[model samples]
Target chain A: MKRRISLFGALREADARGYIEVDVPAHSTIAELREAVQHYAREHAPAISPGLIQRSAFASGDEILHNHRSVPEQGELAILPPVSGG
Target chain B: MTEIYTAVVDIAHGPLRPAEALEFVADPRFGGIATFIGRVRQHNLGRVVTGISYDLFDALALRTFQHIGERARQEVGGPMKLYIAHAKGDLRIGDFAVVVAAATPHRDEAFRACRLAIEAVKHEAPIWKQEHYIDGHSAWSEGCSLCEEHRAEEQRAAGLAATQAGDAHGHEH
Candidate 1:
């Protein structure tokens, strides 16, 4: 299965791309997705700072999840870095 | 139109109107309405800011707004009307950047809900800002630190609530 991740804020800057698709085994943990994202970033967007991913937060739907949480079988995972708005 | 619990969330390209925000939450049942307006400033972090451009992830941003509205309603323990709107694209200094309005039966709940909703939108909404400076250079800001503060406060409050519940259970035993 493929999990689509949407990037925003610093993570979008890091990816240099808005959307990323990662093929994964079913019910893959968020930790795994993070690793895949890191690897993808390294390969596709070398100019982006490495530390941005370390500071990122992931959200599935309305719930922000820890690294240990399981990624749903199908949904867009939003990669959010620190936000700034009023 | 008027409604009891209005949830207005939009990421707009044109200018934002404070009157629209005020109108969204207008209701006779509420004695108080609290509003917060964020405007683009002339300077930031020592740089003479000329203007700002906002970029947002639309679908996720709207979902986050809905989430924030729901949380505010739950926090107040009843129906509450909310209006959250943000500007996208380039905006000049002194223009309204964001508006958050909340209406409840009393002043306290309205204030609390408005505060929480704005903070949540700042912390959770997938919005990015780039400030253009008078030096002919622009840079993306590091984002608001208040989000971290809000998270820590929530954690502390949850811990306190849990401890109180535990103490009550112990007393019962």
Candidate 2:
């Protein structure tokens, strides 16, 4: 039994699947509900001060701030591409 | 007979009221409604508090909430209503932090169940908080020392307010 998701938090497009499965609630939003499923690139993500995080700032500011804000908290369900660390 | 059909996620900028939680649970049999409200404070753990930033680490917040609502439906063994709302963004002093309401026929059930609901939320929910001090510093209160910056700032602010309050009373007295 699949529940019809009212609002979703997953990426618009998954690797080969494209955006589909993730569904959140209608009123329940994270950080002003600004989402860009496709443009989830590491370099594009907001930069954080490394230690003292703005906490809600990332979740509340204008989506455009994603690029402009000095720091950003990685949103939940935000797709982070594979990273390699040695 | 009512249904558990709603849940929300938002920034708590002030005190969250549970009774007002009714708009979310619009079922008639719910003669008994139990609500809980959480507030933001000037001091948390003795930290000289300025402000805080809150965020949800997991979309699981709603998922868990829905699960709770469903479980309440089952436990109540009747048509029931439930709602949970939380605030986000920059919540200032004495703002609603969160509100949860559950409707039952008996007040006892409503109160007991609502308490359990909130307890589950606090322990199981994945909410986070970060503190901002009057100084050029901030920290994650989840696991950090209380900086004097926030307390000193709070005392100073309170003193200023108290002095004003005292002056007003003095004029009347």
Candidate 3:
């Protein structure tokens, strides 16, 4: 399936750095998704707060996936890198 | 008294205004508004500050911040309103970095609460400040600023770095 992966600020180079349009099979677990994010992050740029690749995996802990307000996919989730305040 | 809460962090094409923040909790009962807005400065230690690299350890950091607010509220008054936001990522010179606002009935309590909140924030929160100095030097803030040994070590490192660069330049010449 196709899903958008966004990395703001310094990580915006993914478009040219060969990190975009990465494929993920359906029913990928949260851990698998997080690994995909880290893979893309490393490919695009140096990893910052790699731990957040795990912490931000599901967006929030309230509900398995839906409770997350940041990156919400019906049953899917995102593992975003550590981002700064606006 | 009404209880109000507004807490989050963001980056912007603009800056943060303390007065605008206070409006979030403004009400008839709020007779006082005290705030702190931290602006990016031009200097730090020895090197000039060019910008900052902000990285927040949110789970523990925000949890601890909420706890401090709860504690201060107990000491000051119940149902007091607060709005605190920390800027993340790169903040250029003159950009806003930190903001804190506290509201209460009497001015005395409001001022006291504001003072305590800012002080508590610096020491308690896990917010780390990494400075990118203007002289091609960038590093995290060293703890224990009052230590003479630490200062001496810093001096030595700067001296060595300068000497190494100077020698390389002389060799090329």
Highest-scoring model, TM-score: 1
lDDT of 3 at B102: 82
C-alpha local distance difference test of each model: 0.72, 0.46, 0.55
Candidate 3, A1-86: lDDT as tens digits? 54554332233334543234445566665455656667865775454445434434233312223211223344222222323232
Off by over 4 Å in 1: A14-17, B1-13, B144-173
Docking quality class, candidate 1: acceptable
Return the top candidate by DockQ.
1
Tens digits of lDDT, candidate 3, B110-160: 777777776666644545566788778776553211122333443465575
DockQ-based ranking: 1, 3, 2
Model 2 Cα lDDT, one tens digit per residue, A1-86:
11111111111112233322233334433322223221222233233221222211222211212323332323323321111000
Candidate with the larger DockQ of 1 and 3: 1
Error of 2 at B117 (Å): 1.5
Candidate 3 chain A: 10-residue stretch with minimal lDDT: A61-70
Report per-candidate DockQ: 0.45, 0.03, 0.04
Candidate 2 local lDDT, residue A86: 5
Could you tell which candidate, 1 or 3, scores higher by TM-score? 1
TM-score of 1: 0.77
What are the TM values for chain B, all candidates? 0.77, 0.68, 0.74
